[model samples]
Target: MPSQPTLAFNRDHIHPGDRLCVAISGGADSVALLLAIHAANTAPRESLGVGLSAAHVHHGIRPDTESDADLAFVEDLCIQFDIPLHIHRADIPARASQARETLEEAARTVRYDFFRSLIASGHADTILTAHTLDDQAETVLLKLLRGAWTEGLAAIHPIIHINTPNQRPGKILRPLLQTRRTEIEAYLHALNQPWRDDSTNADTTYTRNRVRHELLPQLRTFNPSIDQTLANLAELAREEESRWQAELSRVLPQLLLPGKPVRGGGRSVSTAPGHSSLSIEIERLRPLDPALRRRILRAAARQLGSRLSFDETSRLLALCGFLTLPTVAARTGASLHLANGLRADRSPREIRLYREKQSANPE
Candidate 1:
């Protein structure tokens, strides 16, 4: 039999009077995470105190198996451990269509939103997810396939601040981030713990499932320790991103134009009826390297609640340089209308970003 999991948590950030809300899906990884923490709490560990609870998201996508099976397992598991279980239900298909996102993307959004609601309502302070090293490897592979940037290659952070609309921010911690999937299952098996398997995990039609079952196996054939390789890559990336983000933060203020709405100026006007605009001095950006320049522009776009694709970022940069506005060719400036109502206008000195007037309601 496999040895029992040595339950350990990164206790530096966890505090007394802080309630931990573990996101349990009745899967082996989550089951291990909760059970380990509960065990620690039972023993009155200083780090993981007795304040342990769980939140489960029931995405009723599989009418046959998930609607009843998954939830029943989680409910039973929580009861057995005597942990408080908070259940939230979401119609992932409907959410996907309404949000114009893929079903996977919609499910993720709904899950995090549920966690945020729990925090906003004072139900839990720290939200924990059971994303293992295998999951991290799978994520890095997915991002690599999609041509991700350095930040994307970082895979997942061990902890991050979670925020929702009008809600006070809270932290989400991944205690089992370094744990492997096989190790989780072994831990559960050693405890004779039972967990429900999601029927969809076997569905190769899903990109993640395919990556796990197909691509990962092929890659392992080349490198016997592919999982470790990917995990190491992610760890290196996380450290690099930590340093890079700090530099990015320092450089952003210097590049932003004074009295021209650049860093934190995208919120108020974007929601209001009238037009909203922000500007960055061309001179400040011109001195930076191309990679840094693109990063700055991408950061600005993100603040405005719009993520730019590679093509979009490239075209936007072109607008800042030589591209002249088609309609306003007679003028010295250039204008490029982007997603939502965001309009980018560039003069010789500065580039301004704002929402244009739209007659039609977004609803």
Candidate 2:
């Protein structure tokens, strides 16, 4: 028998009176999480001092017979454990068509919307999803392949806070973030439990499927512990990202100024329809390290509801006249029109970023 997987819930995150909901999809990872949580709740010596609930979302992408069977299995499992279960049936294909999104994107949006509804309706205080170490590894590799930055390499986060329409705060927690998929399956097998396999997982057309099925196995030939190694990289990146965020918070206020610089005793605001504008003094920006400079430029764009890609950030930095060295003279009267109706302008003394009022584009 395989050694049972331990539930490593953070004591700081879970409270005695908290209502925790486990998102189960009849897959090995999710089924193992629900089982572990339920067992902890029932064990006299190991009780977590919290209520347990289960939720399942049936994405209507697979055949009805297959999807319906998964739902049935989840329902029976919940009933056997005497746990409250919530079920959501989503027409994912129709949703994808209507929203002009891929099936994967639509399914994720629908699933999160349902989870948020549960929290807003006071059904659960926290939602737990079983994202394992393997998932983190896959995410990190995908980000690397896409030329992602440090934040992207951070991959999956363990905790996410959601603000609901009803003014209540909800949390999404991943308790199994450090556990491996092999351990999860072993735990289920030890319990004589069977999980439904999603047939779509075999489709290599999806980038993640190819990574999981082909790339990871080949990588294992070179490094047997590649999964764990990648997961550790993500953890390290997350720590670095947290540190950078703190530094940005401390330094941004002094460097960033609001609106255009006053020229000849009159403010020269852009005629472009924009909600707000932000400026940073070139004198303050030029002396900083290149890393800090890029971060500040990205931060300023973010304040205007725009995200700067790596190339975009480099372009903005070049516009500020820091091509190869800080000693380069600052440029004046240069402006860049960016995606999502955001624009950046360089003046003699400052660089300004603003969002032109256009059709709302969510980040």
| RMSD for each of the candidates | 4.9, 3.5
lDDT of each: 0.80, 0.88
TM-score of every model versus the real structure: 0.83, 0.92
lDDT of 2 by residue, 100-175 (tens): 9989889999989999999999999999999999999999999999988899999999999998998799999998
* Candidate 1: residue 314 Cα off by (Å): 2.8
90-202, model 1: which lDDT tens digit per residue? Answer: 88999899999989999999999888988888888889998888898999999999988778888978898977666677889988777888888877777888887888899
lDDT of 1 at 204: 95
Off by over 4 Å in 2: 1-12, 264-273, 324-330, 358-363
Best model number under lDDT: 2
Error of 1 at 140 (Å): 1.8
Residue 37 miss distance in model 1 (angstroms): 0.7
lDDT, residue 73, candidate 1: 89
